[model samples]
Every structure is written in C-alpha cells, then in structure tokens.
Target: MERPSLKSWAEAAPRLVAVAAGRDTADLVIRQGIWVNVQSRELLPGHDIAIAEGRIAYVGPDASHCIGDKTKVIEAEGRYMLPGLCDGHMHVESGMLTPAEFARAVIPHGTTSMFTDPHEIANVLGLEGVRLMHDEALLQPVNIFTQMPSCAPSAPGLETTGFEITPEDVSQAMQWPGIIGLGEMMNFPGVIGADPKMLAEIAATQNAGKTVGGHYASPDLGPAFHAYAAGGPADDHEGTQEADAIARVRQGMRAMLRLGSAWYDVESQITAVTEKGLDPRNFIICTDDCHSGTLVNEGHMNRAYRHAVACGCDPLVALQMMTINTAAHFGLERELGSIAPGRRADIILSSDFHALSVETVIARGQVVAENGTITVDCPHLDWPDHARSTVHLGKTLGAADFEIPAPAGANGVRVRVIGVVENQAPTRALSADLPVVEGLIEAEGAVCQIALVERHRATGAVTNAFVEGFGYEGRMAMASTVAHDSHHMIVVGTSRADMALAANRLGEVGGGVVFFADGVEQALVELPIAGLMSDDKAETVAAKAEALGAAMEAAGCKLNNAYMQHSLLALVVIPELRISDKGLVDVTKFETTELVEKVLQ
Candidate 1:
C-alpha cells in the first residue's frame, strides 16, 4: 500500500478549516472534557474538541457551533482528556508477539504511538526482517513507527549474527515509509572509537534529518560515555541510575528511563526529575523490553506512568514524559502528542490522573479501545513459512555437547561464571571453585552450566560456560532461541542430559523456549517467528510464558522473571561475562576469555 504523503494535512485542511470556522459539521465532537494539556502543562475544564478527517479540527472552551445533525457526540462527563501515550523506546519482538498482536495488547492501555526497534529480527533475517516489521507496523490501527535497525550483531567481533547489516542498508531503510529514524546504536564502543561502519550509519540517519536512538549499557559516566553522546545518538534508554539520567539530559539528549517487565530502572532514575530539579522536557519514559505476560497483566506505557507516579513524580509531569515529551524527541510534536489543530486525533479519557484508569481510548478520530478491550482491528502481514522455519542447528546434540572439561589432574578448578544480576541487564564476572569429577567440571553449588548453541549457521558449535544466580538445585534445564544480537540458542541447566533435551526440543519445534526436568518436558512456548516472537495472541503466549516461569520455579530456580535473564545470557554487549557461539566473552574487555583459571595454593 502506498504511504500517505506529508500533504495529508493539506488535503484535510479544507474540512478542518470548515469545521473550525463553524461553516460545516465535524465527524466527531467530544464535549465538556477537562483538557489535560500536556504541551502547556495546564488543566482546563469545560473543553470541547472538534474532529474532522481523522484530525483534530479545533480544541477550545466550546465546540457547540461545530456540532451538526450528522456529527457523533461523546459526552466526557468531566473526565480528563489526555493525548494518547507514546513509547519512546521499545522492542516489539520482546513482547513475544507480532506487531499487530502487540498493538492489540497495548491499545486498551491507552498507548496509541510506539517507536520500536526491530534489531532482533534484523539479527536473524537482516534488512528483509526489518522491512517485514516496518510494513506490518504501518498496517496497525494506531501509530506504530519503525526505526531502521542500526545494529544486527550489535557488537562487531565480539559476536556474530546470522545476517550482517551494512551501511547501505541503513541509508536505504531511512527512506522507507513509517521509519521514524535509526534504531538504538548498541555498539557504543564502535561509536566512541569512530568506527567507519557505525559512523556511516549515524551519518545516514542524520543526513535524512531523523532521530538516532541510543543504548549505552555501561554505567561509566566518563570520557567514553561523553564520546558516545558526541557520536550523534539523540536519545538513550540504557540509563539505570539518577546520575546516568541527569548526564544524558544535561548533554542535550533525551534521558529515557525504561520500566520493562524485568528491568526495574525507573524508580532509581526518576529522582532526577523530582529531587534534582532538571528540566522534565529532556526526560522520557519507555519500556525497553516487555514480555507478553507483562503486557497482558500489568500494562504498557501506562504501567511506566503509574510507576513514575508512585516514585514521587507528579502525575502531570509523568504524563508529559510519556506523551508530548516523547513525541517531541522524535520530531513529531506538531503531528502528534496533543489534541490540537492538524494533529492526529489520538486521545484518551481517564477518570483520575493519579489512578490513571484509562476508560476510553480514541485513535485517528475513532474509538479503538475502551475499558481494557480493543475495538478496532490490528492488521497482520503474511509471514511466510520460511520466516517461521528459522531454527537450523547443523546436527542433533547429546549430553556431551554441554560438558565443560577441567584441567588435567585437577580435583577442583576455578572457573569464570556469568553472575546474573536481578532485574538488570549487566551481569557480574564472578569466579567460583567447583568440584572436578573425572576431569569434568561440575557445577554443584550456586553455579550452573550455560551453553550457547549456534543456530544461525547450524555449525553444531556449543560454547560451554558457568553462570551464577537462578539458584537451581534440581535435575532440570531451560532452553531458548531468543539470545540477543545473535539469536542463538541458550541452554542453562544443572543436568547435562536435561540440557540436551531442552535444546533439542527447541530445534525440533523450529524455535522457541523449552523447559525440562527429571527426563520430562515441563513447559514450552512456541515462537516460530525467527525464534524471537510468536504469531499467536499475546494472551495465549503469556499463559504459556507463565507456565514456563512456573517450571523454572519447580526446578528450584528462585529469581523473579528468570526467563528474561535466561534469554539474555548470550548478549555479549552488556557487561561482565556472556557466552557466544565462539567462546566465553568477557564483555568488559570485549575479548574471548578462558573458562577455567588455575588457582594455586
């Protein structure tokens, strides 16, 4: 389908002008609403909005003159009329559902706009994957804008992806319709060092006059951080501390504090606004990654808004952060973010600003959702069979594939382990002394074995390592093909046999997550779409995901949302230690490191 040109506003101008001038009737008129003006930061009562051609024609004290016999009228009954919420940064794939299903899940939560990064699919299917996500996004009932994926492998040399994205790919995607800007540049080191490829991508987005999303995972607020900020990323969502949030905004970049399902960074960072007295315009709220379960049970941007309010942020300030503040960051303030002339008629009705009960949701002058239920269709693209059949594990594996050999004649060995930090992306590079049984290292205590199975090239390569946390004690294993950047299969377990079973189960089902315990399959969630997302409804996927979480708990793993931590075990860009297809990676040094180091007495 051909995209609507920028002259759409011009085309709708006659109808809008007619309605505003009281010469013609509006398609819809919402009367007597308490306007929560995010742009002006004011609460004005007795406001009536006139809508025509799916755009706001006029918003003022009264629209009684614009009402006609055919005009559909909605009495707000003294409800707060708010602009539809906008997500400044997120990954649609992380929802474990297609863009259509993700929109279905969040529309009722009053989210009408999203700026999504499709780098997860890019790692598996390259530019073609990104285009698929983009096309589907445009078909949604709400405004779902795509950002050209800036990183496929995410970190060059540190990891390998099934497909590599080139600088030309970035340039070409910038021209694609509905592409807001370049996606988050996860390769911060590459940007700081002025790598040609990274700079070329950044230049392409800038040349197109678009925003550049950022992801600086490091906690360092030093020279490297400043250099990355200078490398042309307009906004960042990886800030986990108040200082991190303050520094980004101070440097003229939007500090996006995320509150995803597993990532709880908003509480720590929102203090920058409440206590530090920084200008709230440069701050944004987002969910970097939310699973299907979170979207179904809690909320989307609404959840983030509520969390911010609970953290002592003023309700109006938090709403602005999610609405106009986000829209302005993407250079879309006039086109969206408010109920004003020429803006898309995307608005929400809430009974209380503090409670945030989204009673009614309006998108493009039509009621799309009301009272936690979607009213409009979220169209889907025809995802071909080839896209579903993405799992390619060169050959079948056995228990031998997930084994770690100890040094010769060593009774006990000290091994580098990836320590899982609860509710955070970065892991700790920890060392543990473990028992060696017949030259084979065994994780008998708090440490467990982790392996990265190469599914991209089907090389039958399995990089074995150890991981702390999760507190697994029984004979069980969990496997998933949702490993970040590379999209490889990650298997973590106490028993090698169960680990092999879990990995092979995913390979058999094309790609998804599998949990096994005591020689029996405990639970499974099938994600046939690039092993990252499911075509199934978000609710269905969430149910299965809840079961998988239960299975993890049954295996003695005691971590909140442990599946999220399991899926990111192979993310080599963030922090201390990660497993890759090649070997164990020490992310701090960005080098492959040995598994075991000799400890002398």
Candidate 2:
C-alpha cells in the first residue's frame, strides 16, 4: 500500500485560516457537542468543530459559517467531543497482530493514535523488521508512530539477540519518516554505569531531538535510579507504586502508568495525582503490552482511561493524559493530540465519560468507525517470505531435552525456583526443596519445568529451570515464541513428552503460542511473522487467543492472562528471576546463578 504524502501544517495553514474566516468551506463539520477541552481542562457545551484537508480549521461555539452543501455534518447528540485517545507507549506485536490489524482493532474503540516500539520484531529480524513496521504504520489512516528499538537483548550479556541495536542503528532510524523516538532503554544498569554504547544510543536520539523511552524495572529508587534518570530517558512506564510516579515527575520525567493485558499498575500508581496533590500533566497512561483478546473485548486507550477514572483519577485529567500529554511528550502536540486549529481532525464522540462507549470515531476528517465497526480499509504490507519463517530448532526436541538432571549422588535437592506474580511483571526468586525420582528432580504442586530453547541461531541448547505459580495439574505443556527481549522459544509443562511436542509444534508452524494437555494439541494462535505477529485480521487472532486462554484455564492454570506471563518469562531485564538462552538469571543481581542451591542426602 502506498503511504499518503505528509502535508506540512504550513502548507495547510492558509486554507485553515480561510475556513475559519468564513471565506472557504470545511470538508466536514461536527455540531452541537460538549467539547471536552483537554488543554483548558474544562467542558464547553454547544461547540462545533470544522475540518479541512484532514486538519482542524475552526473550533468554537459555531462552525455554521464553514459548512457548505458538500460539507459532511455529524450531530454529536450532546456527546463529549474528545481529542482522539493516544497510547503513549505500546508494542504492536504484543497484540500478536501486525500494524494494520492492530489499527483496525483499536480504531473502533477510539484509539486514534499509537506510539509503538517494534523491539519484539527487531530481536528476530533486526533493522529490516523495524522498517517493515514503520512503513506499514505510516499507511494507517490514524496516527501510528514507530519508536526505533533501542534494546534487542534488553539485558546485554545476560542473553543474545539475533541482531543488536547500535548507535548507528539509532542514528539511521532517526531519519525514518514514522520513527518517533528511541524505544524503551531497558538497560537501566548500563545507563546508570554510563556504558559507552548505551549512552551513545541515547545521545543519538537526544541529538535528533527525539524522546528516549525508558524502562527502569527495579524497585530501588536510590542513587542508582537518580543516576539512571540523569543518563537521558524522557519517560518511564515501569512504575508500580505511587512513590515511583512521584519520583519520576519530580525529576522532570513523565510518569507513564501502564495497564496491559496482564499488568494492572494504574490503581497502585494513580494515587500520586488522585490522593496526593501532585500535578497530573506529567503523568501519562500507556498500555505497554496488550494481547488481541484485550483489544477486541475490553478496549484500548478507552480501557486505560476508564481504569484510571475507576482508580479515582478525574475523568478530564485521564483524557488529558491519554491525549495532549502523550502528544506533547512526543513533540507532536501541534499536529495530532488535540481538537484545536491546525491539529489533525481526530476526534471521538461518546455519550458517557465514565463508560466511554465509543459511538462514532473520526480520524483525519474521515469517519473511520461507527457503532463498533470499522468503515475504512487498513492497508497491509506484503510481508516477505523470510519474515514469515523464523522459528528454527536445530533438531526435533524430545523428552530428554527438557530433563533437569539431579546433582550427582543426591536423594533430594534444594533449587532456585522462579515464582510468578499475577498481574505484574516482576517475579520472585524463591528457594524450594523437591525429591528426586531416578536421576531427575520432579517438580510438584505449583512448580513446573521451564526450558529456554535457542531459536535465533538454532544451537539446540536448552536452559532448564523450575517455576512455581501456574498450578498445572495434568500432563500439560505450553510453548510460545513471543518471549520478551530474547524472542526465543520458552516451553513449560509438567510432562516432558508434552513439552517436547509443544515446542516442536511451534517450530513446525513457524511461530505462535500453543497449548497441549495429555499429549493432545488443545489450542494454537499462529504468529507467522518473525514468530511475533500474525498478518491475519485482528478478530481472527482474538478468537484464537480467547480459546488459548480457555485451554490454559482447563489445564488448571488460574492466572489471568497467563499467556502474557508465559511470554514475559524470558525478560531478563526485569527482577527478580527470568530464564534466558544462557541460563537462569537472577535479575536483581544482574547475573546468572546456579540452578541448584544445595544437595540433600
């Protein structure tokens, strides 16, 4: 699909002025709406908005002068006319859908803008992959900006990625049309230590006058955190506490509260503004990672804002966080974030502020969706053959590949177990004692075997560990190629045979999440693009994801959005424990540790 040639605001200013002065007619006009003024933080009833050439030409008490015979007028029915909501930070691959599908899914929910980091694909396909996502995003009718992935193997030396994002890559991407800023700098320790490479990447983005995204995934807000903030990250979304939010804003950095499919962080952090008297301007709401089910069923930016309102944030303040605040953070405030003159004519009409049931969605002067149905075509890229085939296990994995051999001459073993925390990114580093059967230590109760299978280089190496929390009962297995940061294949299950089957199935299908119980395949969501996203429609992928969740519950897992938890198990950057292609990682210590703690006789 050919991308639309971008028209500069200067080129359209003369016509916008003419329309506002009543010398020219607007292409579209919306009348009789209660304007939700994000900029002034007030509600103005009986307002009209006029658009010309996909940019707002006039906004005030009346746009009657700008209306002509050809003008498309929409009666808002006293609905709140809001600036289109924006997702300040997210990953399109997290939805398991490509750019086109993601836009299609969210447009109906009033998400007119998206700022996405394509690092998931960058880990598998590198610069070419980033370009693919960037180009496709530019073709969307709504705003979909790309952030050049700054970290591939997010924790360097902890794991290896297919390709690394260097200062040169960052510099080159800054020149891309859709590239908004550098993706989240997940190497917090490196930035704090002033690692030359990490600093160089941040410098390139700063030099280009672009925002440097942040990921300080630690609870330690000490001198280390201060040093990291000084190293040049513009915003952070890893905050899980009120103190974290206040700390970031105090340091002149935006505090991004994220509410993804699995991570519920708004209620804990929103109190910084709701309970405390902190200014809300510097606070942003984002969805760091959301799957297709969440997008299709719950909502997008609407979901985030509604969740914030539920957590006691003012309804108007929440809209500001999702709209102008995000736009200003990305240096796009004058272009797309608000419903003012010269800004993109992206607006939503809703009857209720609390529920935000999107009745009509407009983007760039076009009614894109009405009553929860998309009216425009979201173009797709013709993905090359290489992009579709990425999974490569050196050979067929078998039951033996997953076995964690017990320490020699031991009746039982004390081992390091990863404890997963529901509705959060951080895991717990735990110690557990389990009896050995034959030559292997068997995982019991809530514990399950986890193995990271090398897929990028097909080394046929598996790093085995134990994780407790999924509560699997039967001989069940789950495997996914959507493992965070590393993009490797993570297989977890009680039965080694089923684990082998699950891992091989993803390999055969190229990439996706698969579930198996009692040696039978139960559900699968095929993500054939770099093993991260599906090129199919969003609804199709959402249905598969929904089924995958049901199958997970049927296998005795009680965690909400367990697929997200399974996919993030390989995120070595976040504390306290994670699995990587190399070995078990103690994230708090930022190093690998021995799997077995002690030998029991």
Best by TM-score: 2
**TM-score of each model, in listed order:** 0.98, 0.99
**Candidate 2 deviant stretches above 4 angstroms:** none
Model 1 residue-pair collision total: 1
lDDT string for model 2 (1-601, tens) is: 3457546789989999999999999999999999989989999999999999899999999999999999999998799999999999999999999999999999999999999999999999999999999999999999899999998779899998888878999999999888889999999999999999999999999999999999999999999999999999999999999999999999999999999999999999999999898999999999999999999999998999889998888999999999999999999999988889999999999999788989999998899999999999999989999999899899999999999889889899999999999999999999999989999989888889998999988888998999999988889999999999889999999999999999999999999999999999999999999999998988899999999999999989989999999999999999999999889999999999999999999
- Give the C-alpha miss distance for residue 130 in model 1, angstroms: 0.4
Model 1 stretches with alpha carbons more than 4 Å out: 2-7, 599-601
Query: Could you give candidate 1's per-residue lDDT for residues 170-210 as a string of tens digits?
Result: 99998988899999999998999999999999999999999
Q: For model 2, what is the error of residue 546's alpha carbon versus the real structure, in angstroms, after optimal superposition?
A: 1.1
Clash pairs detected, candidate 1: 394-458
